[model samples]
Target: MTAEKRIPLHILREITNGFSEHSRIGRGGYGDVYKGVYSGREIAVKLLHVDTVLGHDDRQYINEVGNLLKVKHPNIVQLLGYCYEIQNELIEHNGANRFTRHVYRVLCFEYLQGGSLDKHLREESFAPDWSTRYKIIKGICEGLNFLHSCEPPIFHLDLKPANILLDSSMAPRLADFGLSRLFGGSHTHVTNRVVGTEAYMPPEFIKDAYISHKNDVFSLGLVMIEIIKGSSGYSGYIETDEVGQFTQKVLGNWKNRIKATSEYPLEESHQVQICIDTAMRCVEPDRNNRPNIAEVLDILSKTETHIPKRQMADVFPCPTIGLKSESNMLEIMVAELNNNEHIHCNLMPTDNSNRTVQQLADRETSSDVEQVIIGRTKEKQKILSILSESITEEMVNLPIYGIGGIGKTTLAQLVFNDPKFQDYTRVWVYVSQEFNLNKIGNSIVTQLTDKISNIPTK
Candidate 1:
C-alpha cells in the first residue's frame, strides 16, 4: 500500500466549513460524512465517531485507509487523503465542563454527484431501463474481481447498495472500506466478531462465523437482485425459488420491461437471463457452491459479446482499458455458458412457439390512451394476473402509489380496458384525499347500475 497524505484537521475543517450542518451529506455506522473542497476539487470527508472509534485502538480507521491505499481500479472509490490528529477540546464530565484530549480521524474521497446506489434504487418515481441497471451490476462485479485479484486480497465485508456510489454516467464505484479485510494466502477465515448489515450477510458468517471471498459473493447476489428488481431487496420469497423458476420469473420481469422500453429487446433479455443465473448461483446457501468473483465476472463479460457490436459501447460504457480479450475466447465462453447444463437458455422464441408474449400484445385492446405508453407493460400484466387469480367473490383493492407523472393513471387505464377482465365487473373510481365512503360507494353503485343488476356480490 502506498503512503497517503496525513491531512491536518484544520485543513479538513476549512474545506468542510468546520463540519457545519449544511455541509454534512451522509451518515454511516462509523461516522458522519461531509462534502468538502480540497485542493480545488470536491471531496467527501468522513469524520470518525469519537466515542466508538477512538477507544478501540483505531483499527477500523486504519483498516479502511490501508485497503483504500492498495487499490487503483476505476470501479473502486479513490482515497484522496486522510486525517489523524489529537487535540484538546471542551468536554462535559461529571456535571462540569472541562478540557480533554480528542482524537480526530477522517478519510476523504472524490466526490461523486450521483451519490449512493441505494438512493437511485429507492426513488420509485424514476427508474433507469435495463441497460443502466445491468452496467451498474457488471461494474460492481468487476470491482469485486479486482479486489480479489490483489496479491494480498481484500474482501469488502460490508457490501451493499448503500456502500456503492455512482458517477453522473451511472457507473458504480465501491466505497466504505471500514469493514474490509485483507488476507495473505488464506482463502477463508473464521472470525468470532461477525459484524455487518445482517440482511446482506451470508448464512455462514451469521451461524458459523466462517468468512471467505464467497461472503462478498452472497452480498453481491442480493445487491444484484435488488438492482435487477428495482430495490425490492429480493430478500424473502425471491431468493427461495428453485433455480429454473427464479430465472424465468426475473427474466420475465425484465423481458416485459425491455419489450416496452428497448430497441434491442432480444439482446437485453438474454443479458437479464445471464444476470439472474449468475445471481442465483452467487447466493447458494453453501459458500463452497458459490462462484468466485473471477468466474462471476467472466460470465458477466459474455453479455458484451451478445450485445450488438455498435451498441456494446452504450451498454457497457465503462469497459476496462489496456486489455482486450480475443473475440473467439468470448464466443468460447458463450459456448461453455450454453453447455453449463444448469443454465436455462430461454432467450427468444424462434417461431410461433414463443407466441406467448406476442399473444399478450395481440390481446391488448387498442384504446384512446395511445400514443403508446412506454414502460408499464409488466406492471399492467402483474395487476391483471393478481386480479385474475385473487378475484374469488371478494373485494380486492390494490392501491398503486407514486409521485406525479409516474403513469399510475395510465396503468389504471390499461388494466381497466384489458380484455382479460371483460367478464369481471370493472369499476373505475378515482379517489381524492378528502374521501367519502358514501360518495365512492355511490360512484361504484352508479357504474354497476347499468353494467349488471346482480353486482356479483357472490
Candidate 2:
C-alpha cells in the first residue's frame, strides 16, 4: 500500500494558523497535535519537534507511515496526508552561529470529535458505562488482531489510553504509530534501545528489547486492565506483583464485579472475565507464554456475540449530563449512523490474502477521482475573484442560487479546495429541506474548533 498524499508545509502552516498555541490540542513524544481545517474537513496535524528530529526519529517516522500504508481497519485512525519539507534556518552550533537546512515532518490524521480514550476515562465525569466499555474493549482487540495478522506483522510499541482516540459515536480508533515496527517474517527483533511507554511495555520488551506481535498483545493487555480498573490502579498493580500475581488480582476484581450486581447478566460477566483472563495471558513475562492477539481475540469471542441494540444513552448527545429525554433508541442510532458516515466503518476480514490487502490498499491510495477534477480554469478564477472581492472580516454572506443538478456544489468544492484560502477555516453545512439552526450551528462549531465547543447535539 502507498502512503497518504504529501501535503505542502505552507498549506499546513496556513491551516494550523502558524501552529499557534490556540490550535494546540495535545502533545506527543516527538511533537504537538494541532487542530486544523482543510477542504471543509477537520484534521489533526502532528508537527514533529525540530530538536527531537534525530536520525532514529526519521526512521521511526518512515516506519510509522509505511506501516499505516499497509493496514486499513475500522479501529485504526485514517491518515489524511503528510508533509516532509526542509528549510534553512540560522542556529548556534558548537558555540558558534551557523545556517543549516532541516527537514520537518508533519502527519495529518482524521479528527475524532470525541477526543482520546484517556479523556473520558475513569477520572472524567463522562466515563463510559459498562456496555460502552465492552464495545471499546472489543474494538481494540479487533484492531490489534488486524495489526498482528498483517503479512510481516506490525507491532504497536505503544498501546496506552492516550494513544487510543474515539470518534463521535464513542468508538475507539487506534492512533500514534510513531513507535510501531514491522516484523519481517521474524519471531522477534532484539535490541538494546528499548522504547515505549513504561507502564504498557511488557517485561521482556523493556529488559531485552524483544520485539514481536506479542509485544503489542502484552501492551494491549495492560490497556485492557486499565480500562476495567482505572488508570489509578496502574501504580498499585505494578508495585504489588509480577504478571502472575497481577493476573490473580485482576481475576479477583472480575469476580467481584460479577457478583456485585444482579443487573449484570451472567453471560456478559463471563465474557468480561474471559477478556480479563486473555489480558493476563498476554502479560506473561516469557514471550512464549503470552497469547497472540489472534488467540486473545478468539478467547474474547467465546460468549454469545450479537449486534447490540442501541441503549437509551445513544439518543442523547450528553447522556452523562443527566438530561432527561424520551426517544426511540434504534431510530436515534440509525440517524446517527446516517449523519456521520465516517463512524460507520466496519472490521475487515482477518485473513491477509494478497487480493484482500491489495483491494483495501487500492481503495485508500487511489487518486483517480482527484486526478479527474477537470479544473475549470476560467470558472475557478472567476469564483476566486468574486470570493476575494466579497469576503470581509464581518462575516459577509453570499448566496449562489442554482437549480438542482447544476454544478453549484462542485463550484463550492473547488473554492474550498483552492490554495488561496488555505489559511481560513472552512465549514460546509448541508442544510437541506430540514433546516435546523441548532444543528447547523453545532456542525459549524465542531468543524471550525474542537476545544471551545461542547460535543454536538444532533
Candidate 3:
C-alpha cells in the first residue's frame, strides 16, 4: 500500500505550540523530542532537523517506515506517524541574497519515560544496579531475536547505547530506524552504501564487506561489553594488553570467590558470573564466533527468572486529553487564501501511482511578475508546513503552480520533507507528465488509508 502524504506546516506549528516547555524530553542529532498527550494517551514526538539531509533517494525514509509497520514485537519501537513539509528563508551566498528553503521529516512514537540505557549507565545519579542492568541486557537480546526471526529477516544497521531506550519500568526498547534494512531470502548479502555511526559499526560493515544478520550480532556484542564494564569508552583500540588482562583477572577472581562462598549462596553470585561470561562470548574478535540473536535469547531466557520484571504503566499517569477536529479551521484558512485566486481545487479520482493535482492559472502583471511568483511560493510552503504540525485526519492537498522548469516541482519537494512537518504521517509522489486522475486519486486514498484498489472517488 502507498504511504500517507506529507503533512503541511500550519499543522506543525499547532502541534509544537501545544507541547509546553515542561514536556520537552531529550535532544539528539536529528532534533528535540517532546512528551505530549494525544487522544488522552501519552506519546513521544521526535522533531526532525530542517537542515538534516535525508539524501536524494526517498527510499531511505520509505524503507524505515515500511520496516516499522511490519514489526509488532513488544521490544521494538512503535511508529505512530510522521511529518513532512517545506520552509523558505533567505540565505547568504557569495554576498548575495539566495532564496531557498529546506524540506523536513519528523517521526512520532510511543514514549519511553525511563530514557535510554546510555543515560542510565552514564549518569551517576541514575546508574542502574547489577540486577537492573542484567534485565536490560536480556530485553535488548529479545528485541534483536525478534528482528532476526523475521521471514526475510531485518537488520538494525545501527545498534548502540543511545539507540536503546528504556520504558518507565526500565524495560529496554530499540528505537531509531533511519538506518535499518529489510532483507529477502534470495539476497544473501546487501552491498549498499555504508551508513551508520562510526564507533558502533562492525569492521566488516565499515570496510564494505558483505553484510548479513551477523553484522548486527557483532554490534550487539560490543554494546553488551560496554554495559558490563559500565564504561562508555568503547571507542578506539585497546592501547595495552594490560586493560584486557585486568578485565580477565577480575573475572577470574570473581569466579573463584563464587566457588568458595558457601555463606553468600551460589545462585546470586552465579547470576553475575554468567552475565560476564556471556558478554565475553559476545565480543569475540572473530565474527564467526559471535553468537546469533537466537542463541543470545536462549542464554537470556535461562537467566530470566533471576531478573525481575517492572510494569511500565505504573510509572507515568495517562493524560486526559481529547482529539479536536481542526478540519473546519483548515478549510476556512484555505478558502481565505484562495479568495480571488487563480488556482482551482479539484476533487478527482486518483490511483496509487500519482498525486491529486489542483490546476492553477497564473495572472501576473509583467512589471511585478517575479516578485509575485516568489511570494506565492513561500506562502504555499509556509501553509503546507503548518498543516503538517496539526495532525488532522483529512489529507492536505496544495498544488504549486509555475511554468515548466521554473522549480515548481522542486519547491513542492522542499515543502513535503520539511522537519517542521515530521509529526504527521507522510508520502510524496511526482506527477509530472503522467497524470491519470483515477490513478492519482487512488494513490492518495491508498496512502491515507493503506488500502489497495476500489477507492471511492469524490
The TM-score leader among the candidates is: 1
* lDDT per residue as tens, model 2, 1-458: 24338889999999999999999999877689999998899999999886424587777677777777777899999888888777888989999998887889888889999888776775654543455677788899888888878878888788888899998877898998877788775658987775778888777776777777877887887788788764534631343246557656765665565566424456556666677677667767777888877777777665534322223111111112122231333234335445664331122222222221111111232223334444344555776776676554333444555445444555556666565764554546666677655555545444433323333354
Score each candidate by Cα lDDT.
0.73, 0.67, 0.61
**Cα lDDT for residue 70, candidate 3:** 78
Could you give me the TM-score of model 1 versus the true structure? 0.64
TM-score of each: 0.64, 0.61, 0.56
All candidates in order of lDDT, best leading: 1, 2, 3
For 1-458, candidate 3 gives per-residue lDDT tens digits of 13553444455445657445766787765467777665565667776556634464345556666777777877888877666666677888899998786776666788777778787777754533455666678888888888888876888867889889988877799987776778886534657666667786666667765677777877787787777666675774343455567467645654564456423334535666566666656655566787888987777667644322221111121232222333443344345434525323332322322333322222111223333333234445565555545444444444444445444543454555454443433445435476554454444434444444343333
lDDT of 1 by residue, 1-458 (tens): 23447788899999889999999998887789999988889999999787523654476667668878878998999988898787888878999999887778898888899889888888885355888888799899989999988877888989999999999878899998777887775767898775678889898898998888999999999898888878655574344637678677778888888999887788889888888878888888888899999999889887765353222111111222222333333344345445445333232212223121111221233355545565456567777776666554333456666545455666677877675654444456666778644444434444433321222211
TM-score comparison, 1 vs 3, better candidate: 1
User: For model 3, what is the alpha-carbon lDDT of residue 161?
Assistant: 90
Q: In model 3, where do residues sit more than 4 Å from their true spots?
A: 1-9, 18-37, 49-56, 85-102, 125-129, 186-192, 236-265, 304-458
Q: Could you say which candidate leads in lDDT?
A: 1
Distance (Å) between predicted and true CA of 210, model 2? 1.6
